[model samples]
Target chain A: MITDFTPWQSLGGGALIGLAAVLLMALHGRILGATGILGGVLRFADMDDWRLKAALLVGMAMGPLVLLALTGQTPAVEIPISTLAIVLGGVVVGVGVSYGGGCTSGHGVCGNARFSRRSLVATVTFMVTAFATVYLTRHVMGV
Target chain B: MKLVSALLIAVIFGIGIALSGMMNPAKVLNFFDLAQIGAGTWDPSLAFVMGGALAITIPGYWLVFRRAAPLQAPRFQLPDTKVIDRRLILGSATFGIGWGIAGFCPGGALPALGTGEPEAFLFVAALIGGLLLARALETRGLRSKPAI
Candidate 1:
């Protein structure tokens, strides 16, 4: 049983995300959704976003390097799952986004602001599902 | 110019996710661990992140909405679909399972590449595969729908 509150870091990071979202919408008239952005670009010749999307991806990839250079440290990440689980999970998420139309950024962040009923519903649905999943895995299955 | 600006914004976003600790899968998975839901062990940092993001984006979006169009682009491009059908529910449920299992959603997953995590590479690759396959199916469905 442990609880930690990193108020400044969380708040600062979140504000940056908000700023990026706002800038994306303001400047490009696009949503700051990673899934939609990447997915749209992966569609071969059908995408008009190849160039910009490639640049955005490059920037995202470089973000940590910049952070590491500035802070001289990287955040700790522990993924306690096998490669198989990760692969399966990623594929499942892709299929889910295909069906639901978006994920956290698209629905949770952008869609909510737009006051879209679909986003609201989608957000609630995923949150509940996430809660239930953890409960079942941690409590019931003990896995 | 657009590419450079997009790169800058994405860099900022990626750094934000890293600084916020959202880039860590364990941090997010811990939040989803409902075994501590009622207990004091629950991590609420994600809430602060969500609140902070929404605090600025909400008003910022509205201000832009008031504008006839975007500052640089021709017009605002917003989603319009509103149906709450089975696809939405089932898809979200499926996504939740994967997220709960891995604690890495799309946004959380991508920026980890910046951190050079080996595991992130696998997840991103698999996600891309899923998206490509599903998109192929989606287009096929659309193409065949008219015939049926």
Candidate 2:
């Protein structure tokens, strides 16, 4: 039972993400799907496309710096899970996003905003699985 | 112009995720732990993040679509498919399980790189490896054919 409920901060941050997604669509007419963007960055492709993705990735990498400048301290992030868990989870997420065609940003944020039925299904599917997984781990397995 | 704008927008995205505390895996995991809700321990911050994002993005998309084309691009690069296939469900389910195990998703995890955590880097590397494996399998025609 953690006592850290940050509704306002979460909302504000989500707005920023929304604004960024909107701005990107307005400027480039592209969806702000983080996994897709990263996939593009990793996969060698057209120079023009690569430059855009790389630029976006660089900007993402500047988050801590931005927070430091704004809040006067580097953001602190905690990874309570084991390294093995993190790695295995990462691999699962990676392939899932690949086969699923998008992640939270693409399907959850942008896709839902577009009212795409497919995105909605994807979101629901993932959310249900996430809930079940958490339930199993926390309650059943007690891991 | 496009590249510069992309960079700026992504920076905003990075800041938003950070400010929202999505960068913290523990907080995210807490939100996923529904059993804690009865005990008053579950964090509902992630829902607000989604709510806030949709609030802006929905209207933003509505407004943008009104324009014939974007400012810099000639046409919108939206996804073309409307088909909900086996791959989508399987992929999403696996991703969710992974997410439940580790609170980090791509959007959150990417910005986390800024925190200089070796774990973040490792997760990303593994994620890339996963993606590469999927791509290779697809290239080898290992993906099952869609059920029409």
**Candidate achieving the largest DockQ:** 2
Candidate 2, lDDT over the whole model? 0.88
Lowest summed lDDT across 10 adjacent residues in model 2 chain A is found at: A73-82
Q: Please, what are the lDDT tens digits per residue for candidate 1 over residues B1-148?
A: 8889999999988888877767777777778875666776777688777788888899999988777887667877777666778877777777788787767888887889877788998888988877777767767864311000
Alpha carbon deviation, residue B90, candidate 2 (Å)? 0.7
- Writing each residue's lDDT as its tens digit, candidate 1 over A19-137 gives 88899999989888887877766745644478777877878777788888989986666786667878888887877776777888888888887778888888898888887887887
Q: Give the TM-scores of the predictions, in the order they appear.
A: 0.92, 0.96
True contacts recovered per prediction: 0.70, 0.81
Candidate 1 is graded, for docking, as medium
Candidate 2 lDDT by residue in tens digits, A1-143: 36399999899999999999999999999999988899998767588888999999999989777888888986568887889989999999988998899899999999999999989999999999999998998889888
lDDT of each: 0.78, 0.88
Q: Is the docking of candidate 2 incorrect, acceptable, medium or high quality?
A: medium
For each prediction, how big is the interface RMSD?
Answer: 2.9, 2.3
Q: DockQ of candidate 2?
A: 0.69
